[model samples]
Target: MGSKPRILVARAIFPDIVERLRTHFEVEDNPGDGIWTPDALAARLADKDGAFTTGSERIDAAVLAAAPRLRIVANMAVGYNNFEVDAMTAAGVQGTNTPDVLTETTADFGFALLMATARRMAESERYLRAGLWTQWSYDMFAGGDIHGSTLGIIGMGRIGQGIARRGAHGFGMKVIYHNRSRLGAKLEAECKARHVGKEELLRTADHVVLVLPYTPAAHHTIGAAELALMKPTATLVNIARGGIVDDAALAVALRERRIAAAGLDVFEGEPRVHPDLLTVPNMVLTPHIASASVPTRRAMASLAADNLIAFFDGRGPLTPVNRPVAHPRGY
Candidate 1:
């Protein structure tokens, strides 16, 4: 505590963001953005007083044990499933995340994935690319309709409401959602979204989108049993974290033509996809890029940097996820 606080940028981010952190702290950054094991990450954080982490890095009790001087960790992504919040709290370390900045961008990508999934865009592109489009028939590559259809959204938070507004106002689609809690009357009216039971949403909607956060209780939320409730022609989209949807079960559903198609922006154990999911022709997969827009990403990085700066400046954390009851180690 006698010297200036040192921080680790756990992953490669905007160079400017690193420089911004440098002004306030002694910074050690990973320009290469290499994926690090727990031991490796712990080694870097061993001397750091703070850290700016992207969503991929895991910060838990083990890492915290190695970094006795670390006081704060700021995550660039709103979803901090990678973090062990309870563990960090017990270790007297603060956790922060960037929220509200990427809501619109992520929602936009969610809708785009929905449209592409419902319209069979990727499948058709693949067909044409394989030089199999010798002739065009009236019903060729026909997919489900979006307009006048029921749009079911899970996790009706900020991004969910954005998608709801888009569907209701722009596409004339009926929006229904299921969340941990129901939205208020005025807010629901604004988005034209109705809160419904999960079963009802799955069974009735023509399209379903998952925007929920990742938690142990939320794992495989849309598994075999839930998929069985969805209509055969319904298109599914997951822009949320991996492990939210059971990719293996989804692949089975897709292969058996149980569902029309699916679009997945995140996957389980990614960037290594399920072998079955990769082979399923009816699903559209992305490499966790739903929030990858340059501006949004920069904003996320800036916010994370700001959190680190704020904590070191004695302003505390701006978007803290947990509170530590004890003082920082060596403070």
Candidate 2:
């Protein structure tokens, strides 16, 4: 067999993972955990056959043109927007993403964010910290309940399905979802979910969680119009990609109490959140760490590593984003 192909890992990862890649490829890992600019990435990828990447690493048209030898990019995150997929396809490069493995973990986080927001958990904690909790009152931080409430999910993918099942079966909540296509009757029956039009989902739900993929067409899927449709007491949660919601508009809605509150784990132009969002009292904010459980993150890394190993071994990638271009440069 030819010598092992060269691969560069764009960010610092588990050393054991580096060792695993070292076994199959000439691995150049970022030991100091420095963020690579696009030019630096292009320079390193020029001679490598593949790369292991995270969402922050952008492999755009310029990088693709510079790295003619690049065959595959295995992204640790489920979203692959960092990749210029069309440009990569045109340049004969493959892309893989880590999914399924992080579904339950991410769903757990989404639900947690929702509960925190609805219950005014963060704001309440801050109140106590500021010595403002002198005594409990009947209406002190009164918030909505998850039980028997309508839970709306946008995007019916695996993670979204996990959330639906939890809301319907566990919380005794009514589950409604909106997706590009309808789920089969059998699956819907199992989750006790009803598929509805986007507008109806927004207006009727007590809680709305966004889990849809990001694309130009899906930009601002929830914006001024949709936010205006939501109930004044509704809570919104987003664990999906940034840009899926109009951050500025949502911040405005929250500040004015147009909607009850928002729980956000991702934001537009992250890791910088909109200043307006920061000023809102009813909103709960977190860094983009929905899939950050130790075990789950390890699973994601291992799955991405497995994709790299499988691709380089002449077997197809384990979870390819685009099947036809799964191994463009060949083994």
Candidate 3:
């Protein structure tokens, strides 16, 4: 084997990032951005010592079984739910994700999606594009007010706190949040947020946003019953992971006007939205670009690369999701 560690960049990334990796390891980069099948990923990983991955790739037991030489899987996104962490830990594979770098950028997108959905921006744009704007009519795309409205946030992490700060301070909205645990009094006061139960947050807020992580337990956290709880005038925004909201049920709610509108940056089976959601006129959808600001994305890719370089360099990973059984030595 060569003295340098072998690494695979599983997805296309910046050329600069690839060059940076080349300096440290024998880099096998998929610059074409091909979506690798499990077998193909395994085949490529068979001899590699580490990998750089995005959220689309799933590194589970089967993949671990194939890459016996793999020491680390560095995910370029914040959410590592795509990774089977327990399996990676058992197989002595360390996992790391980019978190803090994307917080503010994602939060900004979440609020933007919320505002766009609330004001019926998508619907209005479609109307104009269809040449339907002959004259202004009363209540033509009239939507709910964001200022002084109740903003409910689920999963009060860094991004959630960022959204709360924007709503509470910039928009003069009342903020309430539900998380795995409550924030301290000082933090809550700073954000002007009140901790509430999930049910209350759903039933009361004028707008509800989901920023929680996805786990088996958290799958479909907002579904038919949960959507039924929101007021008819309310809007829902999801900048969280796909499968967190049941796309089918959400589509039904929007079609029936059960809620005013919805903004989805992530979907259940994305890049492929639900057929029903495609037909709903009251929703704003984006292709998972919440953390996609140029600088932020570069930082994310750099962080993922840094994790791989650090792990093979014996310095330890900067944002390790799990401690591996043994560190890479003599690489």
Clashing pairs in 2: none
Model 1 pairs whose backbones collide: none
Question: Which parts of model 3 have CA positions greater than 4 angstroms off?
Answer: none
Between candidates 1 and 3, which one is better according to lDDT?
3
Segments of candidate 2 deviating more than 4 angstroms: 326-331
TM-score quality measure for candidate 3: 0.98
Model 3, 196-219: lDDT tens digits are 999999999999999999999999
How close to the true structure is residue 203 of candidate 2, measured as C-alpha lDDT? 90
* Residue 139, candidate 1: C-alpha displacement in angstroms: 1.4
Tell me how candidate 2 scores on lDDT: 0.92
Which residue window of length 10 is worst by lDDT in model 1? 322-331
Clash pairs, candidate 3, are none
Ranking by TM-score: 3, 1, 2
lDDT of 2 by residue, 1-331 (tens): 6788899998888999999899999999998888888999999999999999998899999999899899899999999989898888788788999988899999999999989999999999989999998888999999999999999999999889999988898999999999999999999998899999999999999999999999999899999999999999999999999999999999999988999999999999898899999889999999999999989889999999999899878787888886556554435
